[model samples]
Target: MIMVTGASGALGSLIAAKLAASGREVVAGTRRPTGSARRVDFDAPDSLAEAFGGVDVLVAVSAGFAEDDVVIARHRAVVEAAANAGVRQVVYTSLTGAGEHMSIAPAHRATERLLAAAPFAVTVLRNGLYAELLSQAAEQAVATGVLTLPLGGGKVAAAAREDLAEAAARVAVEADAQVDNAHRGRVYELVGSEALGGEDLASALSAEHGKEIAYAPLSLGDFRAALTAAGLPPFQVAHTVSVFANVNAGFMGGTESDLPGLLAGAPRRAIDVL
Candidate 1:
């Protein structure tokens, strides 16, 4: 049996539905159980073992967007529960290697270490930045006729979220069927083929909207001040700033990947999602 944690999330829900469509025996693990979904709250560790019981393979989605300590603690609890429940293998969604300089990378790195040391076999899916995130910026640019960001001249190799979800589903199903799993102890870098910059975004917007759009750069200090004035939490502001800094420093774009090999056909273009 295959179990997908964080099933209520966008990526997790896509993976679970794909597995079910393929006729796999899949279970959805969520905090709020609806229909046949099971409650698998990372905050409540005591209930995890029962939630993971009789699971042959566990697809552990990253529990993210929290403080570093909180993220680490939740991952530790999940690891313990999966081990206690006798799960044979675990597949984890992790940050791309290009994001090593980002503020959120440490927790993901720590989780990778924990999974590596676990008793069960593990597969690490190092997913890239989501193109869907850039769609918001595109929309804002279309409205204002200018694409403004702190990215400077840097480019991001953003993959479609649906492509990443499909890759995860395929890996989990293949792992469950293999006697000697080839995916065990392997890390797949799932980055997009094209690296998109500010000008590229403006061009795409212009073509889609049939109007001239321009790219405008913002200084990090001004961006930080705006975020602070907007009443964002200190950690979120810091994390957001870190992403811009990393991208500007050329740490978030790469050409090599295992994404195409995992899929049945060519991966979807980033523009399709935008």
Candidate 2:
């Protein structure tokens, strides 16, 4: 039986749906477990028996603020629950740089450590950035006929969310956990075949929409000014500008291992994702 945490989230729901469709005995777990079979909720240490009565595999999906301490605490709790349940396989949907030097890597790294000492065989799916996140910007490009962001031509090997979901599902079902055992102790530099820069992204949008859209490379300060002019809060605009700067500095994207191969196919094209 496969149990998925955060089953209500976009990627988590997709994973559970795919597993159920594939005829796996899936336990749809959420904060509120109802009439659903094999359901689970967040419970205290003494409540293990009720929380994990019949689960065989565990899939951990996290959705919350990216605070490292909070993330680490939740992930540690998840590992403890899995260990107590004596699950056979443990699969985690972690961010791309979870084991590297990115600011977002610490929580996942701590989670990996907690799981490594446990008895269950573990696999970590170090997922790449999502191309679907570009939809809003893409629609704006199609609307205003211009593609602009703070990203200044740095390339990102963005993968679709579906590809990452498929990989997670596959990780849970594979017969030899050892194939991903090295994956447990290590991080996979997941990426798309085509690394896209902000300039190239604008071009892609132009090509798709048949518009005269062009990339607008702005100074970080100017980008913040634009966002501020658009009525965004100072804090949010600050965060947005900072992230784009990071992306431009090549932090959110990396390329090496082909993540699509883990799903046994090529990733969905960026336009298709759009």
Candidate 3:
């Protein structure tokens, strides 16, 4: 049996559905799952064990927003449960360049380190930034004809969420088929073919919307002020600024990657996502 945690979430739900449609025995793990899905909460140990029981492969998606320590602890619980459940192959959905000093890297890096010590084999999917993440900003840009953010001139290597979900599903099914531990301790950086900047994004958006959209770079301070003025809470404002800083430093950009091959063809562009 293959179990996909966070099945209520965007990527997780997609992965679970795809795996099941592919004729794999899939168990959906979520806090509140419908239909035949099981309820699994990282904070609940017994629930983790129950959800993971009899599972041969485990796909552990990253926990939702929490403090760094809390996130790590929750993931530890999942790892322990997977071990106790006798899962053979573990697949983790991690952020791209998570080993680096990006804002969201610590928890993911810590989880990867923990999984390294597990008795089971693990495959890490270093997924790139999601293109749908920029939809809100893109909608605002379309409304105002300006793509204003604090990205500066840095590029972003982003892929569609559905594409990432498909790759994760494939990894799970293939691991089940082989079960030879060939992917043990292996990591794949799944990203888009092209490294995109704000200008490139604006062009894609303009082409999709049939209008003239301009890229307007803003200072970090101005960006924070804009976010605050837009009614974001302090914590969210801080987190958003930190992510932009990482983008400014080129943390999200990559020139060449195996994403196209992983997708079995050319990955969709920003225009398709828009």
Best by TM-score: 1
lDDT of 2: 0.70
Decreasing lDDT order of the candidates: 1, 3, 2
Better of 1 and 3 by lDDT: 1
Model 3 CA RMSD to the hidden true structure, in angstroms: 2.0
lDDT of 3 by residue, 19-88 (tens): 9998878899999888888988998877787788999989999996677787899999999999998999
Q: Enumerate residue pairs that collide in model 1.
A: none
lDDT of 3 at 16: 92
In model 1, how large is the Cα lDDT of residue 97?
93
**Model 1 alpha-carbon drift over 4 Å, by segment:** none
Ten contiguous residues minimizing lDDT sum, candidate 3? 95-104
Give the alpha carbon lDDT tens digit for every residue of 138-181 in model 2. 78878887776667867667778887778777767652233344
Write model 1 residue lDDT over 14-38, tens digit each, in one string: 9999889877799999999899889
Any runs in candidate 2 off by more than 4 Å, and if so which?
Answer: 33-49, 175-187, 218-243
Superposition error at 210 for model 2 (Å): 1.7
lDDT of each: 0.91, 0.70, 0.84
- Candidate 1: minimum summed lDDT over ten consecutive residues — where? 174-183
Candidate 1 TM-score versus the reference: 0.97
